[model samples]
Target chain A: MSVLRKSTVALVAQRAGVSVASVSRVLNNLPASESIAAKVRKAAEELGYVPDAMARSLKVGRTEQIALAVADVGNPVYVTMMHAVSEVVREAGFRLVLSSTGNDPNDVVELLDNLERGYADGVILSPLRITDEIIARLTSTRLPVVVIGSLPQGVLLDNVRADSRTGVDIAVARLKATGRKHIAFVNGPVDTVPGSARLTGYLAAMESRGLPTTADMQVEASDFTYAAGLEAAQVLTAQATPDAILCANDLLAVAVMKVITSKGLRVPEDVAIVGMDNTDLADHANPSITSVDLGSAERAREAARLLLARIEDPSRPSETTVVSPWLAERESTAEGASRGKNVKARKPELEEGVS
Target chain B: MSVLRKSTVALVAQRAGVSVASVSRVLNNLPASESIAAKVRKAAEELGYVPDAMARSLKVGRTEQIALAVADVGNPVYVTMMHAVSEVVREAGFRLVLSSTGNDPNDVVELLDNLERGYADGVILSPLRITDEIIARLTSTRLPVVVIGSLPQGVLLDNVRADSRTGVDIAVARLKATGRKHIAFVNGPVDTVPGSARLTGYLAAMESRGLPTTADMQVEASDFTYAAGLEAAQVLTAQATPDAILCANDLLAVAVMKVITSKGLRVPEDVAIVGMDNTDLADHANPSITSVDLGSAERAREAARLLLARIEDPSRPSETTVVSPWLAERESTAEGASRGKNVKARKPELEEGVS
Candidate 1:
């Protein structure tokens, strides 16, 4: 017969010269005698006893396991968010399970089905796009789910979305302040949520700034890849070159920087650039790409918290939270024509006046 | 009583006007009448019925789920390898359960202990570092495990490792062939397995080429981060400037590229850069960094296969597989230093000498 080692609780009880019941009570933070608690603590320290959370969770019917299903795990922005989520989850005494669905709706459905098998107490989904069927399924699930993007109307669910409108507004405002009237918008896959949202945000921001939204100023990338960004830049620059360009993400911005430098165009002089997501790549990129922070970490934390809340109270009303985005001005947009003596400078005004 | 939806198989059988056994046999690809199979297939298609592999695995006393536990999920190289592993796992009709241990040995122990609950048929562990205690626990587990890196000597465990020596050798040879005699090595923490192996590989490669391996030529980074890489480059460049620099990973190489470019040093003309891992960052860098392909995808595929083999037959002898690295020459290398140029230049000398 295979022999199993004694558990830490048993060892603590033996070392403390106390009953196993008393040790258990003290360990579980239940009402116990002060003398017994002191003895158990000393014994645990001597024996180097560490409580097994998994076993405790099993008895409580709560695994303390949360699942995060993402469309593309290879993206650095998503990877950073996942890292932040893991840190928060670990600090909260929970385990995280990650699932990569590769930007496919069917794969997302399959991942949701797998999550429904009770492996995780709650789930955080970052689907590439939202559909009616997906929204309905999410609404009906018994487990807690926090989506990492915007959802359609009439389907109540916990959501944490990035305010790309504010992000694009800042980018456009900065560009206009830099005396850049002709600005271009480079986007990735309009069918995707971020792509569509960012595009709409750019258009609205440009219109609010009294800048003409022209067809020639908008360029859509084949995909959210560096190569696609490079190819899209070639097309965008072939026509009238804009004095400033706003990218949907940092990858495209980095690619544009490469192409612009190779073509002997000086950044912030010939053309300024701004990107979204503010990923580590942006900070490490040449010129240290100026980007907008979408509060990805905060969004991840909020989603995890919402999921945990719903897991604790399933009958609670679903909530949607929107995390704001901020501008991170770097070398890419440091000094432009407006900063020089060639353009007029505008005085500081109210935030509403700019937006 | 709560109402539950009918099983897909039952729905398919009802739609086909056939017995449920016939539908089950057809779904399982078992021997069945041609008419019955045709009816079942049509009915399943009409009802959009998809088989639940999880339920079947449970009935057969197997979960058909494999866990992949890594130290850091945010690392792009790991993410790339995970994509490949997921592809292989999904193709084999098995689900993947991913967990991040965050480079903590305690977390590693906890994750492994949790895996013993029989949720997954096997596990793939990519530990940041190997310790005796970890090795002991891994050896004691009945579940099949495939480690991504080296294991302790004489330990019977399957593993897949990258050939860092060959990678460094090829990088050094390419730089030397391009008339770059002075080379520098920028590495991450020497305590890490990859970091130490890469440092040793650089030293061995330099010695093989009869080049001086001076202390000033090697700069150890504080950690595997872009900031550390930037600081390491500053230290390396402060002493004597090397004609070529080899980095431990693509992220580090990108940092070096950014730093060197900012300092007015032209890549390939003033300094050539070569990085390990051949990640997407390398291809997207300003000069399209030259890197050594560590065969991460192949390694992941091999690890999955080894895990499946061990799961099928527990008594089989453990094996270790090493994947050879290859040089991916891009624009980052010196001009006219392509593989074609190297082969052509070497062929004439060999022919003349032999003749």
Candidate 2:
């Protein structure tokens, strides 16, 4: 709603010599006495009074549409999440609508603000970035929101988060099992939430292996894209050849594979590759990439379940769910058990619960 | 809104000896004559009058959201369409929301019915199935709708269509140019619109080449999925081997590649393959698959534009746009000029306009 210097109907009521109800009735074009309506309108015009249009729109009858907002719609992880969330939301008798909130925290805030329009009963937000403004909006938003990623400490909300540190450790352990002595981590920008967590995981995993965990062992890409991965992998290859490389995502893994092959090196033979976010890209990859399944589908399902539960009873306590990660060992790792060997394109894996 | 025998305020007026306006005023909690208000309220209680909840929710105030409904959100084609649609709608100062209406025509009809709640100003529909019920809903919907796929001949709405026949012809002609006499067309369900049109194109191209065009030369998958393609391709290979094959979509082509390679046949050497839609899977495929670019992004952009135009002026005549298809040559076809060699992840191709 647009505001004109805090002009309100209450001010019009005072000038009109009438009650606030009379002012509201006149402003909303509801039934009013002739003299009272005329006096209210004249006073309102003098004060330049404008109602809060956004607040008015917020008044809603329960529309069954539930919104899911993600940073990048193109990411296969989100696609997996979307597919799962769609299924659960549909089963619960709510239509799922997806909103792409680009990689901007401000855009996320704006999206949350617009949700007050009440088209959707609730939203499942998987924001890549979190800002103070976003927190402010989320804290104040009347719509039920269940976040699908990490949140700042102390600001309580229903959240579903994956164990990225453990995800990286699984990738590292898988590579170590194949006797890869020189393991290097290829990461996206360390400034990002996932990027930073993954880098920390790499260091922790190396320590667990009783190997030297240094900054030099990790290379950073500008972004989590195939091109950026190629550029960063090129840099890592020039510095020193590693027997194994852990990519942050599937696209990065594909790029690293292309680079390694172009340099006359074979995957899992000369250099084993492990990818994060066991997306379809990893599944369909040639000699399929070994990746960490970070429970994208599980996270989405839990988030949707939390949202539905909260919608059923908004008084329910804010909850935080940690979905565990698993290793999807494929042909990309030497002698790895491969799901790709199956002719069926997709198989939903059985998940185990973790506290 | 729950209906109680179509009881309305008019009926309350007749029962209470009050004006319809006075009855409405009382029902809506507006100002009315004291005796008339009491009488109307009593009549309403006796009649069990209930309002239309859906109709009441249909009242909108120019909400900025525009919805795009697609059959499958997992398909890369829809992802491409969604990305393009999002950009255009955002540029027009509107938020793009996605609704995944499943493959059922009844689902699409129900979606259209629910859309009367007026959350979005307009919609861009890309339905896989065309049914009478869906057509009726589209025709009668108050929300401005633009279709992104083929509609029935007489049923008119703002429409955007791709030349699937032309897309297939280019693939067939390309294979023929490479001196491949035995060309087989691998398709999804022939009952589908694109499936039927592509099959016709294959026959026409074979006729143009003065070659036999028969059911024996073509194979049909149960559905447009990698597993289905593998099942159908296995059937095709058992009967007879074709030197070149044109697939309905990228998944099928990828599956065909796997089948051919499993039989110790090299791609573009012994069994050349071409896929349609030119999705990311085709781009990133090993020895990347040559594919028909069906202009999914273009179709979406045109669909969004048409809907926006209609929203601006409801009286504007319904329009149709035919986006032409092109070929993205890669290593899957013999002597095919490759674009996969580019290191950059994505490079949008130059588009030629078609009337």
Candidate 3:
């Protein structure tokens, strides 16, 4: 306990009769022989070497820390994106600070206040739904911020957005190619930006295909949770068992699949299931769900790059970048020759029929 | 833009010639009269009212902010626990601040330093592996901290621990009951606290059941990741298709399941699968995975209670509390009399096991 007072790796190395680098290597588990590692380990044990990270951070003028705020971290897509972001940030010599706002505009405001005081060099925010007031407050600060979603018009900022409209168009086109006329769109809350955008995209795609979307074919869930999705699916399935079902997100798609399977319905054979956000769960599901890759890794990388740029120069004119989403065909959709081809290469042809 | 600054419920109430409470009710759509609701809506539009969260946080001593620091935020179990913790904390008037250290000890030190800057009133930390130095540093601090996993021996601190030993015991017991003589235990890094604990637990459970264990039966993965689990499973499966496989965590189990399925084997029928951490994925997996419920909600509640108590009375004697884990039987485990009961009803009998 008394050894904790020094709080230096050098003191431990000196006491152990070894170089500081050797001790550090052992602590970090770097390559070293058993004998040298043994000695360094013994030295560290005797001296109680607790490294002073604060002193190092202060000296570096960079805490190697970045804050990430999301409307909900529970969403599998967001969780997958966070994992990628953390991996890249760690590789780039930075720690990740996470915050969840529960999709509440006020929660985001509270998080920003703490972010200002958290000593993080940069911040990445993924607001569930964007509002003018939230945008104004975010833009008020010159702090390095990279929004993971689109901002409202007139509020310029560094952003990495997912093109869900194109994603929905691709899903509809694939379903249409399978000769599925009646397609049901199960949505989350329409007030949410993604929900509204996906619903609008679904309607536009249906209209472009010269297909009439009956009111019964479109249903909105109270929330984005699996239970909500299941309930929405119940209503949609009751109206008419469409040959194809398109979900706004994977969670909803998963629920739809579960309900469809429970009723002894075969996917693609009885009903084609397509989900947005090709999360890990989609790959791990029973039938290996077909989904649209919203480019989570790309979004994360772009956000990190933008945040770095903003941290380097806060006064630069704000910019927004949009990443395209592509369809990932799997067992959920009907197997065909177009299944394995890269969706991006076929995007133009697919969009022509749907958009 | 000027109108946006003046947009608030108070302003709307003032303009509409109504009480602030009435404006709030109308804005919330809580059974307000058509005339008053219309008037309030028109006034709110005219004023451009948006609630100011920053001003509110400043007025309250509590920013409603709590920080959670984990070795890895990307892990599904941690993500689920965070979601549950956030839900609870939000209900109790607190927002969560998340920080990931990528399982690096140095990052933990950095997180502690930043915590002292008063960004959050309390912190919940989940270190990947505990060392003496970390325990000493954490115990020395007067700040309130609730460690999500085990701490060092003889250190009096508030703790929320998962009973991995019991979880392992149940898993092994079930496999043994299913006549799995050649049981294999796949673990992550033994140097890690969980790896070490679960390994010891597996050995102890085997010994108690009079089951012979061999060195080949115990395989260690590089890390607690999906790829590592797959690689480890390939080794374990190559030797013999063990009647049952018990994984240290759910991700490992999912990976093992994938490998087994790819090899043309069915879960439970060919190879029984059991994993710890009954995460959301467990319920949604292909066969609906069987897992151990580590009482995450209970652990969270206890951790919060202990932290608040410590904050209230730092001079009080420190304590350690262990939250028990239960076995959740799903499609992975073979259906038998043992699997008929609900998870809550059957508690794994804990025998003397090394920590």
Model 2, A1-355: lDDT tens digits are: 2243224545677899977546544554445689987897787667665444412432223577899998877778888999999889887667888999887888888787677777788999988777778888887888899998788899889999989999998888877665666788899888767888898898888898886645655899988877888898898888866777899999899888878877877776667899999998897777689899999999999999999777755667899999999999887886543322211212233111100
> Residue-wise lDDT of candidate 3 within B184-262, one digit each (tens)?
8889999888898899999999999998888877889999887798899999888755667888888888888888888
List the candidate numbers ranked by lDDT, top first. 2, 1, 3
Better of 1 and 3 by DockQ: 1
lDDT of 3 by residue, A66-147 (tens): 8888776767787777876777676655667787778679877777776665447788988888887778778886567889
> Evaluated with DockQ, which candidate comes out highest?
1
Each model's lDDT: 0.78, 0.78, 0.74
Clashing pairs in 1: none
- Minimum summed lDDT over a 10-residue window in model 1 chain A is located at A342-351
* Model 2 C-alpha lDDT per residue in residues B1-355, reported as the tens digit of each score: 2243224655777899866545544544434569977897788678775433312322224577899998877778898999999888887667899988877888888788777787788999998777778889999998999998888898779999999988888888887666566788899888777788888888887898776655766899988877888888898887766777889999888888878777876676667799999998897777689999999999999998888777755767999999999999998885643322211212233011111
Question: Candidate 1: TM-score?
Answer: 0.80
When summed lDDT is taken over every stretch of 10 residues in candidate 2 chain A, the lowest stretch is A346-355
| Candidate 1: regions farther than 4 A off | A1-60, A336-355, B1-61, B336-355
Please give the range of 10 consecutive residues that has the lowest summed lDDT in model 3 chain A.
A337-346
| Candidate 2, superposed: residue stretches over 4 Å from native | A1-60, A213-217, A336-355, B1-60, B213-216, B336-355
Candidate 1 total steric clashes: 0
